[model samples]
Target: MTFEHYLALFIAMFLVAVIPGPAVFAITSASIARGLKQGVNMTVGLLLADYLFILLAISGLAVVAEVLGSAFVIIKYLCAAYLIWMGISLLRAKPGTSITEPKMQSTQSAVLSGFLLTLSNPKAIVFYVALFPTFVAIENMTYPDILGIMACATLAFGSVNLAYVYLGSQARKLLTTPRRLTLLNRCAGSVLAASGVTVAVR
Candidate 1:
């Protein structure tokens, strides 16, 4: 893939990562209630789940892309539509209530909770499968290319997540305010919607 493509992918991933979603809420809540260590374990679980989804997206899309050939364009538009819709939904969503997570008593429990919480939202797999093709040609995927995408995803998602982990109690305090969370979501939604428009028009 071109460097420009990779950059776009990274930016898109970053925009999504910056949004305080389910995973973020969980990690931040755990950290706020417990400690940074618990948050780190939760982050680890979420990252592992992300790795699985990325792998599935790359491998599965490669075959589908190769087979569908020209028809894949339709899928791209559909994915773009989904992205735009998600963006609009987030932008309009009412300020959410404070996050509440089960007390994570141990590292294992923390990790497991994060993993299950992420996996429970199977729509996340759809996010990976849908978005990857907008930035790279999966039909031409290689081992190195796959590795690069995974690395980009890790860096983009990890950085924002770690920032949240570090913020810890402070993040919890800020997020307790619905207006602050809504503002964050709006900023993220703007980026997300613009990205979808870019993909659709490109």
Candidate 2:
């Protein structure tokens, strides 16, 4: 792909990344409950996951996509259910409830959770499967070109997500109040669940 093509793809991916989803909600909640460090860790986990998927998509692994696609409907519903459940749990968190700050998980756990969280969403899989071809010219592209594009995309996503995490951490002070925290949790949770539902329906 030309630089211009890559730029366009980056912009499109950025927009997609900005949309609220389970991952965003999870990161934001972690930030609010823990701190910026945990939030950033979550973002890094997500970036690692994105890189893995991008590599798979680039390598022409249609088998994975095909297998996942076959169960997309089931997976979508399960994800939707998980989101809604998480939202309700957040909504029900008691005021003055002290949540233990999350310690950094093992590297393997972080990467695995990140990959599974991202890969579980059939929408994301299908999206990369379909969108990757538009930006990457497989026949002519060298490995460096593919790696560069993936790295750029990962950086863009990580930067945006980190910003969100910082924002959430900054807002943590306001969330100290039990009522406020509950409300924020509910709002985030609801948004996540709704996104999942929308994905399932679509």
Candidate 3:
């Protein structure tokens, strides 16, 4: 890829990374319950999953992508329902009653949950497949150039996502009040559900 192509890819990926999704929700929920360190760890897991998906996208797995795309509507609805359930549960949580009171989730669970949450979204896979082709010049670019573009895109994605974790961690302070916490949960839930519906309809 040319420098201009890489820059464009970075900008596009950065914008997409900023949008809230299941991965963002997972990080925020983890931050609220477990603390910033755990939230960052969850972000790491998410990044790993994203890299895996990108690899699949680049490997010309168009058949798999098509199959996944065909089922994306159902997957999106399921994701929406799960987010709504989690949000309602959060809304109902008693104030000052710590979600981390019980034993913390194992590292494996955190990583696996993050990975599954990211990878299960077939739309994301298709998006990467479609997106990379626009900026990646297969004829003119060397392998190293392509790798560099991927690296930059990955770094941009991770950095933007970590910022979300930081934001969500700070939200713990504002969530001190039960009402405010409830409202936060509802709002996040609504956003997630709406995004899902939009995905399905699109």
Candidate 4:
């Protein structure tokens, strides 16, 4: 890909990443509830899912995805259930005698949670499938072109998610008391739950 092509791809990905969606909600909540490490872990998982979708699109599996409409719907519901369950779990968590309560989630668990969330978002798959063809000349696309696009995606997505992690971690610092922590937890949980409901109903 040329420098201009790379720049355009980066711009597009950045525009999309800056929009808070289910994946962003999950990552920020995990960061607020846990810490920077979990947030980064989740970001890695999400990046992996993006790469997978990109591969699928490049390999002409987007048509397959579009054909399996019911499968996507099932994935959406599964994602909604998981989000609601996670939100409730956060709601039930009691603040310990500390500014930041250490979470029980392992690194592997965080990674898996992120992977599932990203994989379940059918819209993301569809977006890439449609978006790529507009900028990428599929008939004459090269390996380097694909690599550049993937690199752009990683940089844009990671940059935005890490920004969210920093914000959430900063918010955690302000949550010095149990009361504030509880309130933050409830608010974040509600947003997540609501996002899930919106996804399901839409």
Best by TM-score: 4
Candidate 2: list runs displaced more than 4 Å.
68-94, 102-112, 178-202
Error of 3 at 176 (Å): 4.3
RMSD of each: 10.2, 3.6, 3.9, 2.5
Q: After superposing candidate 3, which stretches have Cα over 4 Å from the reference?
A: 67-95, 101-104, 138-143, 176-202
Instruction: Summarize candidate 3's per-residue lDDT along 174-199 as a digit string, tens digits.
Output: 77775666666555545545544443
lDDT (Cα, tens digit) per residue for candidate 2, span 1-202: 6778778778877877888766676667656655677677767767877887777777675866667675655655665565555455555666555344323244454444444456565546666877767777766778888777787778677777788889889987777776777676666656655655655566
> Residue 19's C-alpha lDDT in candidate 4?
84
Instruction: Give RMSD (Å) of candidate 3 vs. truth.
Output: 3.9
Segments of candidate 4 deviating more than 4 angstroms: 95-104
Q: What digit string (tens of lDDT, one per residue) describes model 4 on residues 1-202? A: 6798788878888988898888888888767766688789988888888888777777775787878878767877877886787677777767643224335367776777677677776557657877866776666778888888889989998899899988887877787777787887787777778767866776
| Segments of candidate 1 deviating more than 4 angstroms | 61-104, 169-202
Backbone atom clashes (below 3 Å) for every candidate: 0, 0, 0, 0
Q: Which candidate do you rate higher for TM-score, 2 or 4?
A: 4
- Whichever of 1 and 4 has more TM-score, that candidate is 4
Q: Rank the candidates by TM-score, best first.
A: 4, 2, 3, 1
Model 2 gets an lDDT of 0.66
For residue 202, what is the lDDT in candidate 2? 62
Task: Give the lowest summed-lDDT range of ten residues in model 1.
Answer: 96-105
